[model samples]
Target: MSLILKDLTVSAGKRPLLEIPELVLPAAGFVGIIGPNGAGKSTLLKALAGVVSHGGTKTLDGAWPDAGRIAFLPQDFTVSAAMSVADCVLLGRREHLGWRVTGHDRAEVRRVLSMLDLTPLSDARMDRLSGGQQQRVLLAQRLLRDPRLLILDEPTSALDLHHQLEVLSLLKTLSGGMLVIAALHDLTLAGRFAEQLVLIEGGRVHATDSPERILTGGTLDPVYAIRCEVFRDRDSNPVVVAHPAQGARAGSLER
Candidate 1:
């Protein structure tokens, strides 16, 4: 269930978006991909999910992951189908179902819906739900896949603080038997939850380690081009506070 990448490169037109010489991720843990915007976080996830064309060798457990073993949730969950929440969630079972969805599939959908607190909205149309609620429904659909590897891009962007914690906590629990990789912008939350942090900058991995090692100003200041202070919370977990330093170079990260 481990993921290994070698000589990986993802490009758009002539500009490379992501490049990794070599990296290995464990089978079961919450891994967070953190970086400033346009740092190729989404591109990396897309490469792993096989949604983007790239040059690399990505193997799972010493072999390529099965097609059905990987499930991905993109940053944008816009769906114009007007499908019901239940129906959208049930689509996860499409690969497993034949002409008709079996009773087991239906039950699984219900279970996932309950887990995501979407039972009340089961019959609600996707277009009618708020952005956050729609995101939850999409997540329920992905969870129903029972994937060996789950990749999410900006999964909490549409949720409130309460729902953000809830979703991340749920992902942490789900990582017990599978790999969960998420691209996150909230460095504090990433530090608090992720077992490991992959810091990306300018299409390259700047660092990879525990949150305590990667959240510090020394490690992050270069990538983000901002002054950052890393401290411990009451629970002794690393907390990062970032602000622009006086006379800081403008557009440094962009260059």
Candidate 2:
């Protein structure tokens, strides 16, 4: 069930944004894509999600995936629709839904709402929810799709510390049954959850390996142009601490 990408390329106008000669991602595991701010992490994720035009061959087990089996959640999780939470989440199952709504679909929606702790807000309007709340709701929708390959862009960007940990923990649990790839800025959290990490820079794959190997000063310092120190938390997860590079002038490390 692994996903394999070959000769993947994404371009805008005449300039290329991402290019992957070859990449193999294991099935039922979590992968973190990390690099500098302008790196192609988002572009790579978007290409796999089919959100952007790309030239490549993405296959699951050497064949195209079945419909409704691949779900994507981009960084922009805003919802201006006037639909209720329950109604909006149910849309995830649209590909399999019938002309008439069924009890089965409603039941699954309720299950996902409770999974993301959004049951209390089930009756609320999508437009009235906060940014973090909308992110969770849309994520629940993607989960309801029951995808085999899940692509997420900066999934934890809009949440508080509590929800960020909660969501990452939940995604780790889901990775046991589906492939989950996310672009993350939090290196410590990424090390804690991702089985492997992919470092992208200048529209190409710079390196791909275990989190321990990729989240190091040797890898990040040159790519980010900043001094980085990798430590370990109580759980032994790598903690990344960044500082101004040795020769960096004051206020030059504003990223």
Candidate 3:
């Protein structure tokens, strides 16, 4: 399974959000989409997921994939306070279950809950869990569908450092089976986890390559407009350290 986009352009109202001349995503592995705010990173994922209208051709494995083959978890997910964690996660199985929840559905819900370490909170109200736990529950909900492509928009934004690592580790493990595309703000984390990286800016793809190739001073500084240093960690992976803009640094010094 592979996803290919040709001359893809997405518009919202009257403004274009994403424009990609050509891009290809391999079937199985984690692909990170990184960029500054308003860079259309999330919009690109939405286009691939078919959640938004776009002009161009998007194909899976040289042909159009099924409509529900892709599962998307948006950046801002509102958990209904009245629903229990188990019930919320169970929602993912709705397409398979039609209108009634069956015994198999309950078993699958338990399975996903256990997989996400949410079994203990299965009966808890959605409002009672912490931000990280809520995110996990939402993830479990998406996993219930066993999608071929999983599109996540800043899925770890509200998580603590520990939970962030936990979620990323889980994603890394699952990357072999699903085409995982995530919009990530943490450049270092993205470098460490993603097999491929796509940098977006001004509604276009600025660069696409391995993390070490794309997360460099030359590629990033031009887009971010700030000086940055790229280095390798002990394991020999790229890490980016950005410097404040000269004007911002001067302003701070005057204080």
Q: In candidate 2, what are the lDDT values of residues 1-255, reduced to their tens digit?
A: 677899999999999898899998886689999888889998898788777899979987778567588889998789999999999999999888888998988999999999888999999999999999999999999999999888899999999999999899999999998889999988888888899999998988899999888878778887888877787888878888889787854322211
Clashes of each: 0, 0, 0
Name the lDDT value of residue 34 in candidate 2: 89
Measured with C-alpha atoms, the lDDT of residue 67 in candidate 1 is: 69
Listed in order, each prediction's TM-score against the native is 0.94, 0.94, 0.92
lDDT of 3 by residue, 3-105 (tens): 7889999988888888899998887899999999999998998888888889999887778657667779998887757799999998887777767788989
After superposition, candidate 2 runs with Cα above 4 Å error: 246-255
Q: RMSD to the native, candidate 1?
A: 3.6
Candidates ranked by TM-score? 1, 2, 3
Measured over all alpha carbons after superposition, the RMSD of each candidate to the real structure, in angstroms, is 3.6, 3.3, 4.0
TM-score of 3: 0.92
Give the backbone clash total of model 1.
Answer: 0
Candidate 1 CA-lDDT value: 0.88
User: Relative to the unseen true structure, what is the C-alpha lDDT of residue 54 in candidate 2, on a scale of 0 to 100?
Assistant: 93
Task: Say which prediction, candidate 2 or candidate 3, comes out ahead on lDDT.
Answer: 2
- Candidate 2 global lDDT: 0.88
Q: List model 1 lDDT by residue over 1-255, tens digit each.
A: 568899999988998888899988887899999999999899999999999999979888888778698999999998767899999999987888799888888899999999987899999899888999999999999999999999999999999999998999999999998999999999989988899999999999989999887887778887888877677778887777777867764322210
